[model samples]
Target: MKLKQITEVRYITRDWDRSTVKRVVKKLTNGKFVRKNSGPNTFYYNVPDIEYALDNLNVQFGEPATKGHYRTSQGDAAYYIWVVSGWKFKLSAMDMKLEVWPSGDISDKHNHFRDRYDR
Candidate 1:
């Protein structure tokens, strides 16, 4: 994907600033983690390489944590691993829930429920 698209996705998914995304992208390129492709209009980055770079970076540097009701990079990584392992997490008013299924589904329905129930 293009740098801008990747940056935007990272911003939305990980709450990373544009500068951080740019810096990470630069690091991936410099370190040869991602194969950069130049097109006529924009530069494209390899998706798997980006994922690998991010996973490695998260592991090496550790994800920053925050207080209540916010998603951190560590949380995102955990969720990613959970989904890949065919599991799902749900936080309820009374307890935290986890489910394992053959087909992993990651949706915002749980978030919606949590938001509505929390308040």
Candidate 2:
């Protein structure tokens, strides 16, 4: 994908400004989320790498450190951000249950909608 395409998609889905999108894209690039391929008149991004980086960043930064079910509007916003950032889950609302595990045991039993949602 190109930078313009990514910025446009994020703007539509997340209502982010172009500058904000550009900043985040820069961060992602610095974090090695996407590789830059500059051509004579165009630049392309590695889509798969970007997806992986988004997922990791969502998990590492979006997930609340606190435990338990989240039902507030703020929680919903965070959840939406996670989804927008490439979290692959099916949730209808922010009332979805969540679990937190400080330990390194992240299993299916600790699903995103369960008691082990955050790490």
Per-prediction TM-score to the true structure, in the order listed: 0.22, 0.23
Per-residue C-alpha lDDT of model 2 across residues 19-99, encoded as one tens digit per residue: 443355445433322224433322223333434444544543555333234456575422323333322222122332221
Question: For each candidate, what is the lDDT?
Answer: 0.33, 0.35
Please give the distance, in angstroms, between residue 9's alpha carbon in candidate 1 and its true position after superposition: 17
All candidates: CA RMSD (Å): 15.4, 16.5
Q: Tell me the spans in candidate 1 whose CA falls farther than 4 Å from its real position.
A: 1-14, 29-55, 61-119
* Model 1: per-residue Cα lDDT over 1-119, one tens digit each: 32222333333543343344345545533332222443332223333343444444344334522212434554532222112222221111111222212222345554565668778
The most accurate candidate by TM-score is: 2
Residue pairs with colliding backbones in model 1 are none
Give, for candidate 2, the lowest lDDT window spanning 10 residues.
Answer: 96-105
Candidate 2 collision pairs: 99-114, 99-115, 99-116, 99-117
